[model samples]
Target: MALGFEELDFQQTPMGELFLRRRVEPTLGADVYEVKLGDEYLMSSLFTEAEEQLAHLGLAPLDGSDLAVLVGGLGLGYTAVAALSHDAVGAMTVVDALPAVIDWHERGLLPVSAQLTGDPRTRLVLDDFFALMRRDPEARYDAILLDVDHSPRHSLDPSHADLYTPDGLRRLARHLREGGVFALWSDDPPDDDFMADLGTVFASTRAHVVEFANPLTGGTSTNTVYVAHSAG
Candidate 1:
């Protein structure tokens, strides 16, 4: 497939800002253009399968009580939107480093994101999720969905690499309540070393794949989601 490119203008949302390419190319083979949050190439409609699946992992087993969720990386807000769709979810807190990305949702740059932003259960936080995890929590969340950068390996920002490291993972893990689940979305499968480290941190660990086709590259892509439980 021949790759095509076009410049996209950006708009602000309450959570972060979104940049969209005005002229979408069929040759590029997708309806949605690149979505960037500040300097981060967050995501596009292309990989929505992975985003939606990440949300499903959190919402699928809800027991119908007050379930609060923290979503890292608002991206196009698919994960946040999907989380709010579940009746079992009482509160959904979305955190992103870029305020412009959030603003895009607030200003209706992305209609789907706007719907989620408008939801009463949604709270958009304009801070790094890692910072929030380290701070005293106003309340403990039932689930934490992390999809920052591409994966534990590739980061939109080099500093974000700490988020996947053992120390960082440990800090993020501490935020969860007993029996709470921490699910992370990776652009690629984690290596043996990474998996081994996760095993030591969580009582039980499991990983699932979300497959997608990248029309631009004409190659099949698979994203992984790692679900770690504090209490098994």
Candidate 2:
């Protein structure tokens, strides 16, 4: 058996080992890009429907002009790019904890990197997203799209676990303007416990299940996009 891909880059982040890989999927006869942390798969080009939907569903509900967005977790840049596709979006700031992931975009290792960096409205910030939200008490945004974790129940890092808590979610609300939207991508289905937690922080919250073809398996798979709003 020959190798289907090669490791283009790898980094030792505080959380674990981060790997960027390009592989050929013989089943579908297409090239697939993947990001892996340790032995766990974080994201892949093969399954990007939910990531894009996080932006679509979140931005679709907004009215008026010049929307400001903050994308938490740079992942493969799918959500950020999708958010920018909206003409009403005036600005977007993508924040990530790992410098190596940001470096991957700066180096043009991914498809959406060029689009995100070249656009005047987009700004990529290297920082811990949760920490930044907590630190910037006066800063606010129209929308904040988070793709940092597997789910509210399954986090990549333990510190990130706090973001799903009531205190942490309130911190996110602080950085969002009145009537602002908060959206997040989860690889798992919507969790009732998490949705209940979200209800405690925001006035309204909903979960969208995005379905896409599963090339590996015979049927389809689904991911969840959770959206909430800060009251006016």
Candidate 3:
């Protein structure tokens, strides 16, 4: 809550005009921001918890076999950076809807993402995530991580709702390799029906509750990550 560094303005595509500032305590990890006009805080470079959660959940099924990871949405590049860290990962495909966010990384507005953007294992795809997945029936990935919107229930884009629907789940299931994982990040806990839908598509499903210390807001904030795996 206390002042840490000079405040700077960042321009997002659909969101537009974001304020990024360093956190005094940084309990969340390192860098944190209070986005103007929104209650949701932005985690920048200090993304240890989120990155670890993505990698831990996505890589659990792979027994060191080379696998391809498809990551939807490259926010702060926490998940992409984390997925690329695994040597068993043969490739990482990152798809983001907003070109402005991608430009920010290319221009170095977001340092964490910029680093991963330059990584050799990464392939950047600028497209609508849902459309991209829908068009690629033959494409298969060992793990697919989706962190596009804030949460499944509260999406910045109305179109994101389709991703949680039964039809969307079916398309997602088609893109997975045997025993592959599908991970989604949600701001709040997942609904029972949402979990059930995931179960229908994947042979197994699990939800992970991630708790992290909030520097600006006291106490702890928890984000739910839903992980589902295809039948081997």
Top candidate, metric lDDT: 2
Over 1-232, each residue of candidate 3 has an lDDT whose tens digit, in order, gives 4366656455545655555554544454444533342455645454348555877687777765668889988767778888877889888888887675566567775557556878888888888888877776657998999886777777766777887887888888888887889998877776788898888788889888898875556777788889998888
Off by over 4 Å in 3: 1-48
lDDT of 2 by residue, 1-232 (tens): 2258888799998888999998888998777889999989999998889899999998877898899999999989999999999999999999999998989999998878899788899898888897787786656789999999889989888888888988889888999888999999998888999899899999999999999999899799999999998788
Q: How far is candidate 3 from the true structure (C-alpha RMSD, Å)?
A: 3.3
Off by over 4 Å in 1: 1-18, 27-30, 37-40, 217-219
The residue pairs found clashing in candidate 3 are: none
TM-score of each: 0.84, 0.96, 0.84
Per-candidate clash tally: 15, 0, 0
Q: Which ten residues in a row have the lowest lDDT in candidate 3?
A: 28-37
Measured by TM-score, the strongest candidate is 2
After superposition on all CA atoms, what RMSD does each candidate show versus the true structure?
4.1, 2.0, 3.3
What does the lDDT read for residue 2 in candidate 2? 24
Better of 1 and 2 by lDDT: 2
Lowest-lDDT window of 10 residues in candidate 1? 1-10
